[model samples]
Target: MLQWKEFEAWVCIEGEETVEYDVQTSEDDRTVTCWIASELGKKFSIHWKNKAFLQDVGGSVKVDGNPCGGTISYAWRDLGRTISKSGIADAATLKSFVFSSLEVTDDDDALISSSSSALQDLGLLELTIYPVRINGELESTVFSRLNLSDLKVHERSKKAVTQQIKLAEPQPLEKAPRVLDIERTGPEVVKFCFKYRPIDVLRANGIAPSPSRLKRKASAEPPRALTPDDLEELADLEEAKNLREKLRALEKKLHKRDKKPRIKDEDGDVIDLTQNGARNKRVKVESDRPFISGEVIDLT
Candidate 1:
């Protein structure tokens, strides 16, 4: 039902969610990378080539990683995802992923420096937007694509779909942010380099880092509230809800009876399975449906 190609021409997303997010930032806070995932799970990363500039009230200059403060050549590429929509046969193409500009704040900066627990809060990452559109008309906001069929509309009508993404609040690493001492490539510019430690260099005597916060919490009794894992599993089951319903219908079609089964031997001798000692020397017998062969076999 999604008219992705038509919507791509005019659909523009201008939003931001604080990360423990995509739009990767370096430890030194010089280079920042931003990324967003579409509803279908396609990833688009924004590369800000230039540091954002801030002019103080006294006319002094401060350089930061905020993309909104400056203009620079930025582009994004689609990182394809494997999405399984119940009724959608073909995968949706990601036409474009664009951020209007970056919005940075002191609080965001502080969040970047705190513990990594912020990464687990999905509500903090996603927005509940209303006034959704369906074929140019505003419709109710339903989060899952499976619910789209519930909307009252003609089958021939074109469907409008919105991509959903949740950005996390970025939290800083606990250890001192390791920054390379390489010469600056340009004013306020830093290049990212991969650094790896050899296993030999690892301190065998040192304790390994603690398990993640969620893991630590999972060791205790789970809360009564539905968790993110539960919601994800539920979403998967929701996609198969129709199949389950069909299976139930088929089961209902099967003829059922509470009486004991009647078995026939090769000699056409009728045997009451419920009678005493029927299990003695009973060879494997060919079986058929009760309605098809008019043989009422009670399984009760």
Candidate 2:
């Protein structure tokens, strides 16, 4: 028994709504064949019958509400009809089907025809048979039919449809310079290796040191010796010190004498302090004579 399964229907009816039919033959031998019939007045009548003799056909039929009489016919051996029956026998057997037809007018002279015997070899002729049938009887009818040429089975292992995406290698991080773990010391300890005699020699001589190194060394070691010329210069300084002391004593004596009381006459004579007590007391004298101890005085 011929098996029909996997049926699919695609129908395009011009000026009419598309209709789909899914029919499956029962596995029981008693329900092996069936007929689907539709009648819409005198305009159209479609009859589909399935028998044990015709089992490889399955497709959809579109009846025009105003079909031209005798403009279309169905051949029992047509691949479309065979596939239509096969599709109805088993819903799982049919793969795909399309039925399309175009109307033609008497005034139009250009007619398109497509002969596709190649589609019949590959089972695709079922899709083209209906359009060709209607095109045969109508004027100015145009029909286009497509046939399968190559059946290519892709090997999934050959290559992936999309290349395997690879993440870019992470950029190597820059390495930081290795820092030495040095221990810090105090400023005095840090100066341990520094030369100290230069500064010490300058301080001993009571001379300020310049930032540049000295060209000549006055003394390389401590406790610098004094030459005879240096001793003579020291003696001169001692003598000058003595003179300054004597001068300071004289200035003290002069200050003490000026602090004492003194008397002076109009003629600028020094007065004796013991006799007249002029130094201790203020006295008025007559202008005619100045007397000392009751003696008459004469004008000079």
Candidate 3:
């Protein structure tokens, strides 16, 4: 909820319609005081009627001298009671102060009870500026109010605000693990190591790992120079192996030939081409010559 009095003070001093203000300085010019007349306050009547005073006003304030590193509080009093209060704190630089309104009256305040015309007759506001320093450090200059007895106050309930937020769950800790490192030894090779896992053997060489077994096999049975007798024996053994292979092939061919049907005549008698069978059927001839077909021959 916006403090009406604080907004009114800020807007009257810094608003676009503010135009200018009257400033009075001390004899030494180290302190400056400023305020606005009620006639000038009339220009903010529209704001008052539309309750514009209930909004926040933001502006920066410049004091004539540097502030001490401390805080100062101010309050507007009417009829022995506090109507509004504000606070200012000296920044770390000690050259300026940050201001904030602590409390302010609502629309029912006595200062704003009368019409703008009537309020103009009374002194609107005043600021008494002074520099306070403690421990050689500049404390915030306190502004004391004066001649605000004619103001009134109207009380109301303060505004209430509530906020809700969602928070994420915290993460759990992780356990320690053995170190694993990988490095490139060459364009086609990669070297890897695990401190506690004995993994240096997995290093990739330029060739595929499948041929490693072949290398082992070659080493297992190394080749040696053959003696003369050994060479001759090997040649004989090779010849015997070839002869055995040929004999097996011949046996296979003879077995296939035996499986065929024997040649027979129309009377179903098997024809024997052996010497005795040929002599029994031979045609008597004076010389060894070809026999003519369809010749009747005697066999004794």
Instruction: Output the lDDT of residue 192, model 3.
Output: 12
- What TM-score goes with each of the models? 0.15, 0.18, 0.17
Error of 3 at 185 (Å): 58
lDDT of 2 by residue, 182-280 (tens): 222211100000011123333444343344444665776789699999999999999999999999999999998666444556666656554556656
Compared with the true structure, the alpha-carbon lDDT of candidate 2 equals: 0.29
Q: Put down candidate 3 lDDT per residue, 67-140, tens digits, no spaces.
A: 11112222221112212211122221111111211133566533443344333322222222222222232222
Q: What TM-score does candidate 3 get on C-alpha atoms? A: 0.17
Query: What is the C-alpha lDDT profile of model 1 across 265-284, one tens digit per residue?
Result: 66778777877766674645
Q: Which pairs of residues collide in candidate 3?
A: 68-138, 68-139, 69-138, 108-154, 109-154, 110-152, 110-153, 111-152
lDDT of each: 0.28, 0.29, 0.28
* TM-score rank order: 2, 3, 1
**Over 4 Å off in model 3, which ranges?**
1-222, 252-300
TM-score-better candidate, 1 vs 3: 3
